[model samples]
Target: MTNASLTDAQLARSIALEAGALLQAIRARGDASGKALGDIGDREANTLIVARLREARPDDFILSEEALDDQARCAASRVWIVDPLDGTREYAEGIDDWAVHIGLAIDGRPRIGSVAVPARGAVHTTDDVHLPLPAAANPPRMVVSRSRAPEIAKTVALAMGTPMIAMGSAGAKAMAVVDGRAEIYLHDGGQYEWDNCAPAAVALASGLHASRIDGSPLVYNCADPLLPDLLICRPELAETVLAAIARAR
Candidate 1:
């Protein structure tokens, strides 16, 4: 589609879905785990997404995990930051929790985004926004990294008296909040712009609270994209989660 015909949200969703399909096809070839599989997927998906965004919105700055860092984006008002393959480890290990991320930050704020879970045949985006999520079941459920559940996340969960759900990928965990599968997704270990921009956009669109663990707004398209922490959760739980995080810190 032409640039004039597609809105930023639509472009984000389309590119993410297309790249996810490409990754799924590549993975269907056979069992190629570890670095080899991860490399192929990351390279191919990044190429597909970058080519499509460049063709569609050549004027917009683009930042991607698989691409070289370009400081020029910091000066541009609109930047598309993406993770061609979030959860590469899970993907390479033949897990279904990996995802493709496409996000557009306008004036350094996440404005539009989409997350594609190819294995699940689902794509969550800011275009078709959902109302506030219902409260999660009793005790509440917290999503955390399967391989490395950060101590801070554990501490928050304990403080809230919630149970933790092991998940793979930043996108997957964040989307879980959007899907109502979990009440909260808190990460403090570390992350970059490409890792959470799209997920944060989607979460915000879904009427959830998306911000830094300290309850600050998430800013993107920075010269240095090393965003260290994120918190996405239902509004009702935001106070408790942030409080727990603050107390733990």
Candidate 2:
């Protein structure tokens, strides 16, 4: 499709959906599991996404989780940040917390993006706000990594007197806030640009609040893709969550 015919948001969603399908197909074969499954899925999805992006937007730069980091993206004004198979371990283990991400960052900020949960057959994107965020649960719910819940997250949960919901994948946790499955997704554990760019764009589009844990705006396409922390939560909770994070730190 021509560039004028497809907006950046549309491209993001299409790429994420296609990548998700590729990952699901790989898993459906049941030939691999654990690390093997994750490795194959990551490589296959990355290849498919990179190839499609190169064909569709030859001029645009791309930064993918599974691909070699190219500092050249720093010189481009527009960069597509992607996570072909987010939560690879979850995906390999047949868990539903994995996701596919496609995001466009313009001027170092996520301008449009999509996050697809193939297992759930759901694709949340800046292009379409199809799901109304569910009403915040009583006392609110904070989502975190199942295996490595951050200490700050626990501190915030305790401060807010809310339950901490552990899940896999940065995209899944971020989308959980958008889907109303959880009211907060705060991560201080290490992460890269590809891990949260799409999710941040979708979250911002859905009217939720997304930013660094310190309340700074998320900037992408940097010399280093290692993003140390992120916060995606209901808008109403931004003040409270940020305050809690500060106190905990």
Candidate 3:
């Protein structure tokens, strides 16, 4: 229960798992539905995560989707960028792909992180490198937003002759690549730091290449906190995917 006894990776995983578990409990109760369910999940999970982080790392800064932005985090060296209850809509609808994210950005780099898909009972973290990721499918598979697949993603998939699979949440799409359910996660739509930081950290540690779609490094803890797009994919496919993104754009 003490921060001194827990490594950053361990802390990230534990926090994410805890928040995911809380989310599961709330959903199981079924007192709310639609936006109400999402609101309750977001509020309760954020409260738990923020309180835990403050207690464990009092000096560290926090950036959470459900909490008010603290612009001061832009100046801090260690910032916990998190999505307390990612895929709120999916979660509201009882979808299995929604997740909880806990990420640490040290010196504007994703240093430690975890993403827990509670419904799927899977936790991917920077602490674990030996996860049995399935082999990449033939021609590769792409994971995208179920409601709005980016046109660039379509172009890339067409260029590679792969099938596109619709999914919910940025975390879910990124984890799909991390767990080997898919080979590519290209998001050109707008997103905030909380949306991708934790997922990026876990993906990078998993040996997948994670970066801005243009292949630039993903710098975090910025003043605006709006990261427009990112690409997470198999290492072997990073170059090809970046190139395709360039051509498509």
Point to the candidate with the largest lDDT.
Answer: 1
Off by over 4 Å in 2: 1-4, 130-133
Q: Give TM per candidate.
A: 0.97, 0.96, 0.96
What range of 10 consecutive residues in model 3 has the weakest lDDT sum?
Answer: 127-136
Residue 151 error, candidate 1, Å: 0.3
- For each candidate, how many residue pairs have backbone atoms clashing (under 3 Å)? 0, 0, 0
* Error of model 1, residue 243, in angstroms: 0.9
Tens digits of per-residue lDDT, candidate 1, 1-249, equal: 574479888988888888999999988897676889999999999999989898888898899999998898889999999999999999998899999999999999998999999988889999885865676877889999999999999988888789999999999999988988999999985799999999999998888999999999999988889998999998888998888899999
Local error of candidate 2 at residue 166 (angstroms): 1.2
Candidate 3, pairs of clashing residues = none
> Deviation in angstroms for 124 in model 2?
0.5
- Local lDDT at 183 for model 2: 93
Q: Distance (Å) between predicted and true CA of 13, model 2?
A: 1.0
